[model samples]
Each structure stands twice: as structure tokens, then as C-alpha cells.
Target: MTPIRRYATAPGVPAAVGPYVQATSAGGFVFTTGQIPAAPGQEIGTFADEVRATLTHLAAVLAEAGSGLDRIVKLNAFLGSPEQLDVYNQVYETFFTDHRPARTTVCVGLWGVALEIDCIAVTGPGGDA
Candidate 1:
């Protein structure tokens, strides 16, 4: 038998702009979609603000999925420009703190947003390590 896949919907987080859920879970892992800076019917903000908002959205999704930032095992980040890497890191540290999940970041064009982030985390009680 295969494990059932579950989708997550977080009311506090912005709804998905595309045809995808906020997060999905299966086999003890929760996978989240890349969250952009703009919320529903909102304007994008500064680079730092965008990064902060993206992470905040991710946190909300994780919480809704029975996971937290501390349970994140990996993260993939995209930035509008390489120059914003420093600012991104500064704001990212504030949320992640000492919990350093494996991460990969890249410079890429993001429609009208400055930053986007997606992550994978353990599903239950800090995960089954």
C-alpha cells in the first residue's frame, strides 16, 4: 500500500496564485510550493520585506501542515538579483535562527517579486529521524 498524500490549506497565508496547494504531505514529509512576495490583492514590497513576507507565509503553511521551521530539512530559494543575497540572508537568519536546514539559492527573474522560497519538512512531532 502507498501512503496517502495530503494537501494543506492555510487561511493565514496567502492563497496560491496558481493551481497548486500551499503544501502537500506524504511519507512523513511535507512539501511546500515556492511562495512569492505578493499576497492576494496586495502590492509587492522592498527586497527585505519581500523575503520576510515569503518566510512568514511559509511558516504559516508549515504550521497548518503540523510542521514548523525547526522541522524543515531543506529549502530552495530564488532571488530577483544576486545583489540582494546579503539582504536576504540578514532577514532569513531572523526567522531560521540556529535551525540551519540544507539550502540552495539562485538568482532568477520572478515575475514582479523580489524573492520566493519553498521548503520540505517533517510532518509529525519534529519528524521521524
Candidate 2:
């Protein structure tokens, strides 16, 4: 059997800057595109704010897909600089608190921003779930 796929679109979530949807769901899971703090080509502030904004985007995407940050099963993160990790984690903790998702963080070359993030979450409570 095939699981029908649904693309995600949420009001508060900014328009995706390129050829991609914010997220998609299938087989009881929502998978999001990597999200940045601001639209591509836009300048961002401190590493902490970047992390916060990106995660906030991720959460909004999830909420629109019938899930929430608490339901995240796994998260993948990219940091433009190794030094950004400490600040990133500090901001990240505020959003996650005790509900920790399985996660991976990597230092990578980014397109003018300090951070990017995405996640896979169980479809819980609403929308296409």
C-alpha cells in the first residue's frame, strides 16, 4: 500500500525561498525541508537569534502539519560555523525543554546565514493526521 503524501503550508511560516514546500507528511510522519532564519539573501543577526528563528519556523511547520515540537522524532541541524554550536544549543534548549528529539548537528557551509534546521515528526493530533 502507498501512503498518500501531503505538502505542508502554514500561515505563520514564511514562504519557502526556493523550489520546495515547507514540509510533507506520509505514513504518519512529517518531514520538513531545511529551514533558515530568514529568506535566502537576507542578513541575520546573532547566532542565538538565528537558531531561535529557525527552530520557531520548524515548529510552525510542524503545527500546521498536525504535529508539534513535542512530537518530533528526529531533528537535523546545520551550523555555518563550529563556534555557533554553543549558542545554538542554548537557544535550542528553550524551545525543546525536556522533550528531546533524536538530533544531529553538523558544521557546514551555508548560504549567508548562521543556521538551518529541519525535522521528522510523528503526525499527531490534527491536520493530515
Candidate 3:
């Protein structure tokens, strides 16, 4: 087994939440933490806004892990309400049209977010250089 490596964004994301690593890599797999629609302290405003912000942060974590959204093979999405599903899919499609990763979405009683998203990506063939 290859040694796992961890990365945090430059200046890193704040720790107002959990202590989990932003992304963890092992054996070419990069698993990201569930990203909420948090604007640091502000509420996760709307469905579209939440989706956009969550994906943006997820993308950055992927980059730090030597991967990108294009490499994502699986995604798990959590929603605070079922009504947001359609709009959520629309916003998700905007970022993931080409690299259509397998996904699972669920409506849950998420505390501080309208949505949360996480992914697992395989590092590209060059294998993290």
C-alpha cells in the first residue's frame, strides 16, 4: 500500500467546523470531506448558491490532492430539503457536464447547510508526479 498523504489549501480552510483533513490520498484515491455551503459564518443561503459554493470548495480540495473535478468517480450529496433537488441538479450539471461521475443524493436534516457534497477521485495517470 502506498503511504497516504494529506493536504490543506494554502492559508487553509478555517476550523470553525470539524477537524477532518480537507482531502486524503492513498493508493491513487483522493477522498474529500463533506463540504457544506458555508460562507465561513454566513448561512447557506439558497439551493443554487449552496451548490455553487460547495462545489467550488470541493474543487479546491481536489486540486490540493493532485486531482480535479474531472477525475471524480463518485459523489455523495446531502440536501436539507427535497425541494432543492431540481435546482441542485441544474447547478451540478453546470460544473460536471463532461465528467459525469456516479452520484448519490439524499435529503437529510443537515444542521447548518442547504446542502453538502463530497467526492472520491482517482488521481490522473501521471499519478501525482
- Candidate 3: tens digits of C-alpha lDDT, residues 8-127: 552334333656677889998999888876645576566688788888888878887889888998999999898899999999999988778899999999776688788999985753
Please give the lDDT score at residue 118 for candidate 1.
Answer: 96
Stretches of model 2 off by over 4 angstroms after superposition: 1-3, 126-129
Candidates' RMSD to native: 2.1, 3.2, 3.1
Arrange candidates by lDDT, highest first: which order? 1, 2, 3
Q: Could you tell me every candidate's TM-score relative to the true structure? A: 0.89, 0.89, 0.87
In candidate 3, how many clashes are counted?
0
Tell me the number of clashing residue pairs for each predicted model: 0, 0, 0
Instruction: Please give, for residues 3-105, the per-residue lDDT of candidate 1 as tens digits.
Output: 7565556866777777888888888888999887666447766778888888888888888888888899999999889899999999999997878899999
What digit string (tens of lDDT, one per residue) describes model 2 on residues 1-115?
6475666567666687777788888888889998888777776677777787888888888888888898998999999888887888889889988788899999999877778
RMSD of 2: 3.2
Number of the candidate with higher TM-score, 1 or 3:
1
Worst 10 residues of 3 by lDDT: 8-17
lDDT value, residue 101 of candidate 2: 89
